[model samples]
Target: MPKLARTIRFDESDAQVFSRPAEAGEWAIPGGFEFSNWTEGDLSGKARQAFANGWLSLESFGRATLVAVAQVEEAELEPLARRLADHFVQLYGAPDAEAALPIAREEIAYMVELCADHSPNVLLAVSRELTEAGVRESFRAITPAEAEIDLVAIHGSAD
Candidate 1:
């Protein structure tokens, strides 16, 4: 295969793309395809750049879909990231990254919404000491344990 501009990819194992944009927003699914809330300046150029690089389109639910893989070649990933970042600044404007200590933190929330079904649960926590010390290892790490919640729903029951 020829060298691609960006290593755009998606997993077949993952759930199908949700049908509605609002559904994706509610779930906080990362817009791995493009920037958000684009402004009038340079955003079109940025989107164009990404398309030139290697933005792949998948047909699902009569709409185009986008996704990316991290394992892409550096030549592709770098340009793709740069263009997409520019596009983000256009849409979302400036970052108001919550900051503390030595770190100027930026956060992105990703939520995958499963239609009429439940996805797996996730536990999130951060150590104060680690955060204060500017350590990132703990930020992205996950530790899951036996847990309980009230999300269960009863079906085909009469009360």
Candidate 2:
């Protein structure tokens, strides 16, 4: 699994950095971060829906690692991508500064471009550490391959 870290800037004074395990589809949010009410199952359900609708791509399904290297606002994202974006904002807070590295800036730019595509096949994974609540929430937009696996797991048949 490939790993990448990026700082998400919500504003000039608030920001949070996150690292993700891309292949495993998990986010490691450090303790002390807080966000609105959300559950792992809720995120999973959304991801499943995205997969069923063919919104997430195979290459990005569980492979793309995104680290918040810059601050992004809900206003900055397209309508469809807002749910996840807002979730991040509510949880980690918005980004506060420009990306620290050229690659990070490029990645953020890429994400912005992808969000504009509005394709259901594009997957997004987000997570946070809520140590105070004694819970950690992770979510992702599911991929076609994962949807097939889920189908097989449920029906016990490829058909």
Candidate 3:
């Protein structure tokens, strides 16, 4: 069977807002982060911390890592892509950040169930959107505390 494409996920953590301090000391817009991914074991703990600091988790369905942090809803496609990548990262955690990666079948199913309600097909249409957005890679890299996401183009359409 052909390898399954990276499943999409949804995370509120991706959205955030912060104000820059103009003077030496100033109060800014007290920013925050949101996201969704698949994290487990020790890494899950870290992800929890990341969440406290501002990060979310979810899981992916197959190979091909696709990451994204959505900010603007140019449309539904961008958010859809981020959701898929978040799913995998949340479930497996960052292999580079953590020593061991955890893969749980049941957990994966649960996550899919949770996010499947958001997108049934899992961003297949969004992939085309990313292509149109001029994003060569379907994946959008997202950081723990950092805000903002790389959006993909809609196939055959220019933004």
Tens-digit lDDT string for candidate 3 (1-159): 111223222322222211111221111110111223222332344333332332112221211112221222225333434453454466545443222223223333333333333322233211211123232212223333333343232234355
Q: How accurate is candidate 2 locally (lDDT)?
A: 0.33
Ranking of all predicted structures according to TM-score, beginning with the best and ending with the worst:
1, 2, 3
Error of 1 at 70 (Å): 7.7
What's the number of clashes in each of the models?
3, 21, 35
Once fitted onto the true fold, the runs of candidate 3 whose alpha carbons sit more than 4 angstroms away are 1-103, 120-159
lDDT at 12, model 2: 21
> How much is the lDDT of residue 115 in candidate 1?
12
Give the per-residue lDDT of model 1 (tens digit) for 1-159: 112111111232112342221211111212323322233352344243332221222112111122212122335433333443443455445352221111111111111111112222332222211123332222121223433322122234365
Per-residue lDDT value at 116 in model 1: 12
Per-residue lDDT for 28 in model 3? 12
Weakest ten-residue segment in model 1 by summed lDDT: 101-110
The number of the candidate with the highest TM-score is: 1
